[model samples]
Target: MGDDAPVVERVVESQLAAFNRQALDEFMECYAESVELRIDGVVAASGKEALREIYARQFSVAPVRADVVLRIRQAEWIADHELIEGAAGGPTMSVLALYRVRDGLIDQVQFFGQRVTE
Candidate 1:
């Protein structure tokens, strides 16, 4: 683990906590101004304003939450295997989210998710 590992973990953890709480402002605080959010290898949103718009819509529509089932950290990167419930009124999902932290803020995130059919 590098010295930045803890910083990466802390920033990611904070983002997770904010998301789970449905606190969009707090969640946004953990991200950089020029952040990128990707889903299934596609760029879903770029920059803080776009991120806010996306999440704001989601937050107003449904009660979504994510719980991390497993986490792996390496230097400035953290990967989380998460169980997401109540996501846009859809089935539960298992998602693998990879996050990259830079200068104490999460600058990029990639999420790959599948419907949990159990």
Candidate 2:
């Protein structure tokens, strides 16, 4: 479990970097073929194909160039999984994510996100 922490942290960091760059293909590479992405405690997407569509649409609509302000408030390995708490100010969302990694790929993600309005 201790050894897995560093490896999992790297994977999570890679994914975040890809996402911030809007590199869908690179981001997808870190995920398993049958990946599951839960949003706000709901199964928003499953499988690489579905996830691809979601990201594609998002990237298409996003600004061509923008700064990424995503911040990791806390991160830890628990019960063979990585638990991450973060926030992205652009969307004003508080993020709670649990990642299940296997074979160096992110197999499942349980995400809890909520909009924050000030």
Candidate 3:
């Protein structure tokens, strides 16, 4: 671990913390206005304001949790494997999300996830 390691760690941690709490206002603070968010290969959102709207709506979810693990950051980019425990609108699920950071804001986000099967 080096000095930069701690800084990257904070970026990852802060992102997850705010996301779990649905704090896009705070979360987007570290992002640029041209950010893009992709989930499961679908263009869920683009642009900071638009992305914010996508995430902000999550605030309405009760008991929502996005448990994240294995985060790696290089310069302005941070990649992570995460699980979105809610968003089914009626059912619970876990989804994988990968974020690409530029200028401290999310330049692009890709999510790879599957529903937990019985």
Candidate 4:
């Protein structure tokens, strides 16, 4: 743990705790009310309400659990891989995410790559 551990936890917990119990509302609390979210450089979602709409439309058939702290770098940023375990013992989906934090909240999340089944 470095000097920024508390800040890291603030951001990370806001991210992980929110989604712990299959609660979308909880999952989203990790973000600021005025967050900017982008996926694949195509879809753009700003603000929590808009994100709610976007999240509602996007669904996955796999089980995804957050792996937020694969590595936490400077200024409270973390590079992590989210693992999605699916049925059939088939493949796992892992999404590497980079979160930018401010004041212990996620201001922006830039992530890419489809779920990788490993």
Backbone clashes, each candidate:
0, 0, 2, 4
Worst 10 residues of 1 by lDDT: 1-10
Candidates in order have lDDT scores of 0.94, 0.65, 0.67, 0.65
Candidate 1: misplaced stretches above 4 Å? Answer: none
Pairs of residues clashing in candidate 3: 31-105, 32-105
TM-score for candidate 3, please give it.
0.75
**For residues 1-118, what per-residue lDDT tens digits would candidate 2 score against the true structure?**
5667676777777776787688989989988899998876788888989988987887767532222234332334212222222222154554556677777788887766565555
**lDDT for model 2:** 0.65
- By TM-score, highest first, what's the ranking? 1, 3, 2, 4
Candidate number with the higher TM-score (2 or 3): 3
- lDDT (tens digit, per residue) of candidate 3 on 41-76: 878887878877777767765546776666666664
Model 3 misplaced regions, further than 4 Å: 1-5, 72-77, 88-92
| Backbone clashes counted, model 4 | 4
Please report how far candidate 4 places residue 66 from its true position, in Å.
3.1
Candidate 1 Cα RMSD (Å) = 0.9
Instruction: Please write out the lDDT profile of model 4 over residues 19-62, one tens digit for every residue.
Output: 44446777677788887887766558888888777655442333
lDDT of 3: 0.67
- State residue 94's C-alpha deviation in candidate 4, in Å: 2.0
Clashing pairs in 2: none
